[model samples]
Target: MVRALSFCAASPPAAGPHRIGAGRSSEVFAEGPDRVVKLYRQPFEPEAVVNELAASRLAHGFGLPVPEAFGIVGRAGRTGILFVRLDGAPMTVRYAYNPLGLLPALRRVARIQHAIHACPAPGLPSQHARLRHQIEGARVPEPLRRAALAALDRLPVGDRLCHGDVHPGNVIATGAGLHLIDWQKASAGDPAADVARSELMLRYGRLGPAWFSRLFPVRMARRLIAAWYVASYRAASGLPNEAIAAWRLPVAVSRLFGRPSDTDAELLAAIAALARQRPDSESASLFSGPGRSPGRGQPECCR
Candidate 1:
């Protein structure tokens, strides 16, 4: 494995390497006084990095609060990029303790969403086309896949920029302003679909419980939220053989059966009520019983 410190040190000693953090695909290294380097892992596409860099540029053109992309580096199968270091703490640590902070956080997220949706760009992919491709390739059950495709077909299509992933972790509340990072999955699409995806991510990841409560109190219809959750997962994580498939459908159904939302209240109550009336079905057991490893019959990404 190529280590961050070794690579950073070799590149330019004048800019000393400083330990930052690493994720599944890359490790961050302090490259300059105000910039960081993202060293990509093996098999991670250089095109993805280039695409994200282009997106960051596009975001900057729109005057959105996003990190400045310095440039990208590639050599001997290794790839990396330089970005302006956002000078702010992750909102996650702060929000966990003060749940009341979720409202403001969500409002900020919504405003960002509004900004992106207002952007005008051409040659963007259609939500229906993308969702259809995903469902066809996704490793979900045929029935569930069909259901998701049907739902996707009903969604409105528009020419708006979508962050694709807008959870709190990607947002940095800085002294200057809130900056968004990670643009590899961005595309132009409907704002509601984007908002729905964020809402689902927040609800399913248990990231915005407080904000959700504040936005849609106990009196709102919960069915709409459940529908939004399922639709978002179907659209975003429908990689045919991805590990996300194992949890996507189940999690979507969970939102319908577990929580109550103003948007999806009726649907949630109906699903949960039906579940309560019937005994647990053993149909899914075949996928879990003897001869099956934890990931057997599931996507390879799970293993």
Candidate 2:
């Protein structure tokens, strides 16, 4: 069951901080000796920042390895978040430099994800509601969208905290330990749906524009990593394959709202087709053959 969280307002940080890093939506700046400020590039609702801060505090309270958030701050005409600074490279960069360590890295990733799901976080947005909104707003065929939404409505509602975007890039490996960041998308929901979302982002989500697809070696490495990652997660969580498989289509439909690259077009089409099929007959097969790994030979749904 979901637990209640305390939402405490935090004071804004001081101005003129040194920039440390930048992401698609926000810029990180060094605040004091222990904290950093994440200033958003565009205007966002205050409630979003409040929710993230609450989630961070909730996770930290559960003894999960997450950065501690101080609170929201407004600086330079943009809203920002002040939180503990983690000194480490993202898992993606680390794996890129040491491809051979992919298996071990995936093991750690799966353990951390399992840890996240082990904790209950109430008072956060419901992932089910969020996916429903995304499915309703996606620019896919009307029939596919409707089918996806219907599938989502039939799934069980869960209260576990899901790091909505649990990709390698969002995981930081420090000397102390691994830390999960980007709590902006964190929500309360079914753990299976959360796991399925990570699978989609790691395997099928585009890294950049269409031209990046030409990197065949990199793509193959990613596929290998994705397969191992999903396998590791399944083992660590001890959740049935069918539970995670059930979420694939709805998660894929929600991902369509991101405007994924053309490379994902065929995979998305396969996911839509599977979503329209009978749930019990072939949905599980979409991610695994009779004897193969969970994602090794599956269709785009597993990719």
Instruction: State every prediction's TM-score relative to the real structure.
Output: 0.61, 0.84
Which portions of model 2 miss their true places by more than 4 Å? 1-17, 214-218, 258-267, 281-284, 289-303
Please, what are the lDDT tens digits per residue for candidate 1 over residues 110-166? Answer: 556656766764544454455456556654445655555554555456667777667
lDDT string for model 2 (140-165, tens) is: 88888988888898898898888888
TM-score quality measure for candidate 1: 0.61
Give the total clashing residue pairs for model 1: 16
Worst 10 residues of 1 by lDDT: 285-294
- The number of the candidate with the highest TM-score is 2
- lDDT, candidate 1, residue 154? 51
Superposition-based RMSD of candidate 1 using all C-alpha atoms, in angstroms = 14.6
What is the C-alpha local distance difference test score of each model?
0.52, 0.72
TM-score, structure 2 vs. true: 0.84
How well does model 2 score by local distance difference test?
0.72
Cα displacement (Å) at residue 56, model 2 = 0.8
